[model samples]
Target: MRNLVRYCLILSVFIMFSCGENTDKKSGENTVEEVQTETEIQKSEKNVILFFGNSLTAGMGLETSEAFPALIQNRLDSLNYNYEVINAGLSGETTASGKNRINWVLNQDVDVFVLELGANDGLRGIPLEETRKNLQDIINSVKEKNPDTKIVLAGMQIPPNMGEAYTTEFKNIFPELAEKNNIALIPFLLEGVAGDPKLNQQDGIHPTAEGYEIVADNVWSVLGDVVEKE
Candidate 1:
C-alpha cells in the first residue's frame, strides 16, 4: 500500500511540474508577441528623411533596397537613428522638373530633405543660372512648409563635354547655395563612383549597386556631420 502511495505522489508531482512548464511557455510567448507589436509601432512613428533627386537617387539599374537612400535608411537603422526615408527620385528629373514636383512632395511632413537634382540639367545643357535659381526656389518652398526642416544638397558634375565654363558654374551652384542657405552640402554626389566604368552601369551614368554603396558613403560624410548639428 505504501509503495502505491509513493508512486501516486510522484505521478502527481510530475503532472504539476508539466502544467507549470506549459504555463510559463505560454507567458513567454505572449511577452514576445507584445514586444514585437510595440517595436513595429515604434518604427512606424519615425521621422521622414526625403531623398530628392534623379535616376541616381532612384536606383535606376539596381533594386530599390540597393539605392543610396535605402542604403542610408539601412545605415540609420543600424545606427538607431529614428528617421524614415523616402526616395523622391525620378529617372530623368531635372532642376526645373524638381521645382514643379517639390510642392507635391512637400505635402508630407519632412524632417530632413536631401536634394540631388541638376545632373540632368547639366547633361542637357540647361543654363546653370536657371538651375541655381530653381534650386533656391525649391529650398525656399520647403522652408515655407516646414520652417525648421533641415536641407542637404547633393552636388553633381557633368562631363567636360558641356565646356569648362558651364561645368564649373554648375559645380559652383551647390556650395554657393549651401553657404547662402546655411545648409549642408555634399561636395560631389559621385565622388568615388564617377568616371569608374566598374562602378557605373553600361550607360556610364547610372551607378551599379557597388557604386551606390560608395555614393552612400560620400553623402554620409557630410550628411552625418550636418545632421548632428541640426
Candidate 2:
C-alpha cells in the first residue's frame, strides 16, 4: 500500500508538470502570433493618404477593394507614389461625430487628410454654423497633428428639398471652409455623378462600382495636383 501511495504521488507531480509545459507552450504560441502581428503592422507602415468621411468614403454596398479609396491606392501604385491610403469612412457619420473622433484617427502620420463629411449633417437639417464649426475643429485637429500635412476638403450637397435657402447655404459651406482654411477643395464630390441615375445606386445615395471609379477619378484629379511625392 505504501509503494502504491508513492506511485500516485509521483504521477500527480508528473501530471502537474505536463500541464505547466502545455501552458507555457500555449503562451509561447501566443507570443509568436503577437510578434507576427506586430511585424505585419510594421511592414505596412508608409506615408499615409487618409480618406476621412461618411458612407461614400466607407464604400457602403460595395466591396472594400472596389471603393474609391482603394482605387486611389491603385492609382498611387501605378504612379509609384509609395504611399499608404487609409479609408476612415463610416456610414451615417455626422460632422460632430467626426470631430469627436478625429484626434484618435490622426494618431498616425498623415501626408494627406481628405475631409469628406457634412452631407449627413446637412441632410439632418442641422444648423450650418454648427456644421462649419465641427468641420473647422476637425481640420484644426489634423493640422495640429501633422503641421505639414496637406488638407483637402471634399464639398458635399444635399437635395434642394431641404429648401432652396438651406440648400444654397449648405452648398456654400465647402468653398467657404476651403477658402478660410486655404485648403484644396473638390468643388463638389458628386460633380458629374450626382444626377446621373446610371452612376448612382438604387438608393440614389451611394455610387455604383462604376460610379465609384468616377469618384476616384474626381479625387485623383485634385489629389494628383496636391500630392508632392512620386
Quick one: RMSD of model 1? 5.3
Compare the candidates by TM-score and give the number of the best one.
1
Residue 56, candidate 2: how far off, in angstroms? 0.4
What TM-score would every model get versus the actual structure? 0.82, 0.81
- lDDT value for model 2: 0.92
Candidate 1 at 161: error in angstroms?
0.9
What local distance difference test score does each model get? 0.92, 0.92
Q: Write the per-residue lDDT of candidate 2 for residues 29-140, one digit (tens) a residue.
A: 9999999999888657767899999999999999999889999999988987768899999999999999989988988888899999999998899999999999999999
Model 1 lDDT at residue 196 = 99
RMSD of each: 5.3, 5.4
Estimate the lDDT of model 1: 0.92
Pairs that collide in candidate 1 are: none
